[model samples]
Target: MGELVARSLIALLFVLNGAATARDPEPRRAKAAWFGNPPLLAVRANGAAMVVLGLLLVTGWQRTWVASGLGVLLVLTTIGGHAFWRAADRAERGRELTQLVKNTAVLGGLLLLAMP
Candidate 1:
């Protein structure tokens, strides 16, 4: 049951964040302004994906595929949202770098979950 608990915890993380982002995407959109036009729409869509996919993962429905999709979303978010390379100062870079590392670890977990 450890695996189930772990999966639920991870999924919960995504679900809560996703719900918040879907409800208010302005901050994410602003952060990723350069990603595309209609940034708000994109942010909301990304958040919605996170919610749906995270639920699928928790429910063990197509676990591998759901995890893979979540991993992809995470990579996109890390690149656009964190972007440590674009930081203008030491403190900013450090903050972004921390986020990048945390996202990387989460992505690793997703990858393990994606394994058959």
Candidate 2:
């Protein structure tokens, strides 16, 4: 029951995130710069993929694979989007640190979803 709830909530989170990223990509574009700043189009594509994958996850198709892959993505973006060590503003640094920790927690939840 908790697993089902977690899966649903995580899917909803991805849905909202993907939609926001697709709609307002500037924020994501800025953070994604660390990895050579791929084209904005690529970022948009990633958001779209997330939406699709999130839908698949909600339906329980390949749950373990999807959860694991999403967990990996969460880890990567947690680093990419919130490397507090590189932040200039103290508040920004703290915010980023919080985001990183929150992402880590979500990643743990995803890992749980991956388990049988």
Q: Model 1, poorest ten-residue lDDT window?
A: 30-39
Predict model 1's lDDT versus the native: 0.89
User: Residue 62 in candidate 1 has what lDDT?
Assistant: 93
Per-residue CA lDDT of model 2 for 19-57, tens digit only, reads 787787778989868866867787777677678777877
Please write out the lDDT profile of model 1 over residues 58-90, one tens digit for every residue.
Answer: 988899999999999999988888878888899
lDDT of 2 at 18: 82
Q: Provide the TM-score for each candidate, comma-separated.
A: 0.93, 0.90
Candidate 2 residues lying further than 4 Å off, grouped into runs, are: none
Which regions of candidate 1 deviate over 4 angstroms?
A: none
Scanning candidate 2 in windows of ten residues, the lowest lDDT window is: 72-81
